[model samples]
Target: MSKIEEVKAKVEIGKTKLVPALVQEALDEGSTPAMILQAMVDSMGVVGDKFSKGEIFVPEMLIAAKAMAKGVDVLRPLLAGDSETSLGTCIIGTVAGDLHDIGKNLVAMMIESAGFTMVDLGVDVPAEKFVEAIKENERVTLVACSGLLTTTMPALKEAVQTIKAAYPDQKVIVGGAPVTPEYAAEIGADGFAPDAGSAAVKAKEIISV
Candidate 1:
């Protein structure tokens, strides 16, 4: 099989020790960094789908994400471009009372790879902190709020409303296990992404509008 395919397979199985080198080898074998990165991201999608199907649990998903992260570290420099021409800053965090960050971190990585400077507020972040981040950062174009629990969904709404109220035109995107597109619209988010890859695409789409 091709080196890129090997990279994807290793990432899917959560081979943390092998993915980085395989990613670098794929890069050396005339595979562009973006192509290798996409392979790893696709692996994560497969992992997520497996998780959704109950074929894998949180530990499995976390390890797969870790493996993908390792592969990404190998491609980060090649994936990132000039910051001055960036799409703009994206403020991302898991909403208040939610400590889940694997999904948040994955979205941050993908969005950063898509060329936005990311200001990650970390987990259990209050809604006011998002506004504070936007106000403090220049060219802030997107705010992404994540909530993995049904219980924290309200925190997600509070975050979107707070940011929108503070800056009427501010673009907000919301997601996590329980967040649906309809609920996102109901809660005032400009966009909703079901996964990290789509989050990057949606972030770019939001900023271009």
Candidate 2:
């Protein structure tokens, strides 16, 4: 099989140590950086699908993401770094009073695998911090607000409202256990995702429009 296909296969199987070398080999074999990166990205889509379908779990998904990340490192220099070919920059965080990060971290990885440059602001992030991060970052195309607890749903709404007020045209996506499509729309979010895999798909869909 071709080196690019091998890279894809290894990445899908969560072969973290082998993917980097295979990616480098693919490059040496005349495969373009975009070709190799796209191969890895496609593999990530497969992994995400499995997770969404319950065929795999979080540990497996994390391992695959880590493997793809290793492969990405090999291509970064040739690709002009991670975000050069990305859909755009995505600023993500868990809204204020919410210290939960497992869900937020998963969504961040899934979105990054989908080719958006991720700027993770971490947990317990204030509503104002989301706006501040947008102002502080470059090429900010999307903002993601996450809230795991029902109590923090208000903080999630505030985050969306704060961002929309700052940049009316900016795309913002909200998600987590307590966030619903109705709530997402009610708060003026451009999109809503129910889980990490779907979050990546919705992120790409919203950002494209």
Candidate number with greatest lDDT = 2
Query: Cα deviation of 31 in candidate 2 (Å)?
Result: 0.5
> TM-scores of all models?
0.70, 0.97
lDDT of 2 by residue, 88-198 (tens): 889999999999999999999999998888999999999889999999988999999999999999999999998899899999999999988999999999999988888
- On the 0 to 100 scale, the lDDT of residue 82 in model 1 is 43
Encode model 1's per-residue lDDT on 1-209: one tens digit a residue: 99999999998888999999998889889998867876775676677667656788767766777887788778778767644436789999999999999999978866765557789999999999999999899989999999999999999999999999999999999999999999999999999998776777788788873
Clashes per candidate (backbone, < 3 Å) = 0, 0
lDDT of 2: 0.92
Regions of candidate 2 where Cα sits further than 4 Å from its true position:
81-84
Model 1: colliding residue pairs: none
